[model samples]
Target: MSAPADSSALLQTPLNALHLELGARMVPFAGYSMPVQYPEGLMAEHHHTRRSAGLFDVSHMGQLLLSGPDAAAAFESLMPVDVIGLGVNKQRYGLLLNDAGGIIDDLMFVNRGDHIYVVVNGACKHGDLAHIQARIGGRCTITPQFDRALLALQGPLAVSALQRLLPGVENLVFMTGHGFNWNGADLYVTRSGYTGEDGFEISVPAASADAFARALLAQPEVKPIGLGARNSLRLEAGLCLYGNDIDTTTTPVEAALNWAMQKVRRTGGERAGGFPGADVVLAQLDGTRPLMRKRVGLVALERVPVREHVELQSLDGAKIGEVTSGLLGPSADKPVAMGYVSPELAAAGTRVNALVRGKAVPMEVAPMPFVPNRYYRG
Candidate 1:
């Protein structure tokens, strides 16, 4: 795992002590001293999550709450997602955009009945907080839950393991969340995760985080995983990593995230073109503006492991784009990647080459979710 140059200034999560006790290799990530892998190794941890359940400590991410009668409507004005139309106890993927339609950050927001619960990437939490407060602070009250700890139990057996501790959790379908009580602690759990698996992400108070993690780890089907496996898992699922795949320079249309924008928010819908960059985004959606580049999935024809920043080129050697994320997928058992390319070359089965170490490695544009998603939507 690559870490920042200066690791001394990193913050520690509530589970830091437990991670050390469990023999995890700590590394600097997003200003935190996080576990990159455990003694079981990245490969083992990656496979464990695919076959059974793997517990992850994601406390470094930001959690916040927006409360007010106007919270939903005010929040909807910041992004293209239909926050006002979202049902209570349901969640939706959202993008925070700048005036030019470039993605400022990508996050998940859940309507918790009384308030909106938001989770942002650890690296961008501070910025996201200020952005939200500055844009919609007048319409709603913003509260940051930075002290809470989050845990993800992801895999095929995740439901069975989690239900033993919280009996009714199995009833929550994908993209939904519910408040629950566990051993006198207030918990907010959502049936969603970065990995394309049946999973749940639980938000517990910082004080009880260690105890809660231990309890979940005690389940026979659960094992501790780290950031290394987490990246590979999400990559196999074709999910975007904020800074890597999408950033302040990328737009929703260019990133192939049109599905995240509902019809109600699009042009001709009841509430159209109110959010930041709506003019640019709506134009791209309606085919008025042409796209120069687009994000696409790629599979290497050779056994070589293509990595990020590798230049993508046409069959005859014209530079088209570059890889944003790539790895030899542990489950897909091949080199898979997500990158940007000329719109004309973004289709599946389109042949291309990845310039790795001055050599041209053959590749083909492929459909995303390199592996099939196993989300329990029902």
Candidate 2:
């Protein structure tokens, strides 16, 4: 996919210099020069994160705060997820959809008392912001928090390392967030991350980000991670990537993200029917149409890395689907991938095949997260 075409200069995160010093291979992503891998390579970095701790620079993402008397009302008009019922300090994954029900982007939305804070994927940030701004009308105030850098500290040792710098950081439970002080600087800490592990994603003031990141890496278990490892880790956990695994052409029903939609957002709710794609989304919710299922998981064969657009076929050579994302999982120690398929063929253990290098390889429709998730529940 092409990066944003705006003539504005690419924005740099506070930790850009640190990444360069660590021998990171920089690449253009979301209009910013970002690291895709380091000297350790993707496999090594991916294993390091699962076994110890890894830090990621996600500053390219867009952060916004919605504040107004009708913030919940305004939000309900853009996405199908329930906002009014969201508890403070809790975070929920949701999608921003266009009027026709096409996905604008997937995002993490946190309810903070009077204001709603959201973090969207970097590649879709501009388009997401523009869509939200145009439809928000005069009911709410949309404020972008561009003066912050987002850092993900993910792994089993994440809490221990973070607690050493910011006491009481371990108090946060899964999917929860809180405002805290680190070295006397204000920080927004959320018990969330892309990797399926116990972790925290902290939003720190731009100026202090570099200093804070340096402090974290000073610990024994903490190490710098890059986008290459990030992708492999998430794929092993069966998580979706914005443009690849999902996009405007897909729906939550097809993407296996129905859990994100709350009961209040159903057709019966007071304001549930006003959001974009309400008709189609509601119909799918009501089961008025056949839902095509797309699952994210691993393949058994160790020979090749599954590439996107590769056709998925039935055992008898009938084409049934296509791959969206694929790679060798450092944690799984094998080739892992995700693809879309017919709903009847989407069940776990269902026999299937994938065409790779002009040859059909035997594969099975397996359950996701090849490895179980280890998020801290308490």
Candidate 3:
């Protein structure tokens, strides 16, 4: 087993040299030296992906292969998601929770016929793997694929660009996956991504990552994208950023992620309350107890942008909540934000105040995906 990352030591992704050569501005993130932005900058990269395809190096995220007949059931013991119900080649969003109903991490799992493939947050992957292995080592094998690198080619033109390299890639629908041979290595291609656009995540050999990314970048519709644009894109799509938006202190329901909780895990289902935090999580789902605060989207009527950790207040000057993630949405061309506030204030059209520099800046609670989602369902 690999030791924990030291405080000052920074790990490098398989595509580190590619990013540097492409003139990406590097920064420390999730204990790795990663690209924060590229030469075209965040704004350009954001808009480019919206209009065309942008290739992203997400190799820092953990990829694991959970094998054995009991893998699904054993995996379910650690999270609130219905792993057994996931069909072959299908994928689902999952919440990893603690015993007290707070989120340990949010992840995505794919059923690969004989085994399950998982992708976890870059920062939480190590701890998440250790947790899973410790809890279910007797039932199944959790093998971390450290030798693989993940790439996300995202945007409206992602399909066309990807199809140029691998024909028939456009045939895949949203949340579906298939294994393909690329560059003489077995690759797993999933028609899913975090940008809320129609895209795909490619899992390839770490040794081939640079060449794979270069091949994608050579396409007319593709360009190299960095982390800065990725953050803004996900924010506009109302997706949560692990530590900033959700942590051990936040529950799935409180984070407006009830959709990620499968029906089987809720009250009155066949297999209810077996996983971690099922008591509190299912109770929240059943509405037996009222929820105090909930995550909601906000749109700035004013042009000024609000940032994370800023206090949110009610019209009466009472602090209701605080911003978890906020930024100027490039696609929406407006300041968009997501934060926690009293449930009563979480609805659309509700007026609220953000304390910016000790002054109350007014905004409205708006429905998310501030821009529409363009996932291909077929």
For TM-score, the strongest prediction is 1
Model 2 misplacement above 4 A = 1-9, 296-298
Clash number for each model: 0, 1, 0
The estimated TM-scores of all candidates read 0.99, 0.95, 0.97
Highest lDDT among the candidates is held by which one?
A: 1
Local accuracy of candidate 3 as per-residue lDDT tens digits, 105-124:
88988999999999998889
Model 3 whole-model lDDT (C-alpha atoms): 0.89
Cα lDDT, all candidates? 0.95, 0.85, 0.89
Cα displacement (angstroms), candidate 1, residue 240, comes to 0.1
Model 1 CA lDDT for position 268: 79
- Displacement of the residue 320 alpha carbon in candidate 3, Å: 0.4
> Model 2 over residues 1-378: C-alpha lDDT tens digits?
435544266667789999999999987788787888999888788888998999999999989999998997788778888888889999999889877677889999899998999999888887777888888857899998866899999999999889999989999999999999877789999999999988999999998999999999998999999998998888888899988888888888788887888877875748666778988888887889777666545485646777778899888888889899887667777777899998878887787778888987767777788777999998
Q: What does each candidate score in C-alpha RMSD?
A: 1.1, 2.0, 2.3
Clash number for model 3? 0
lDDT of 1 at 370: 95
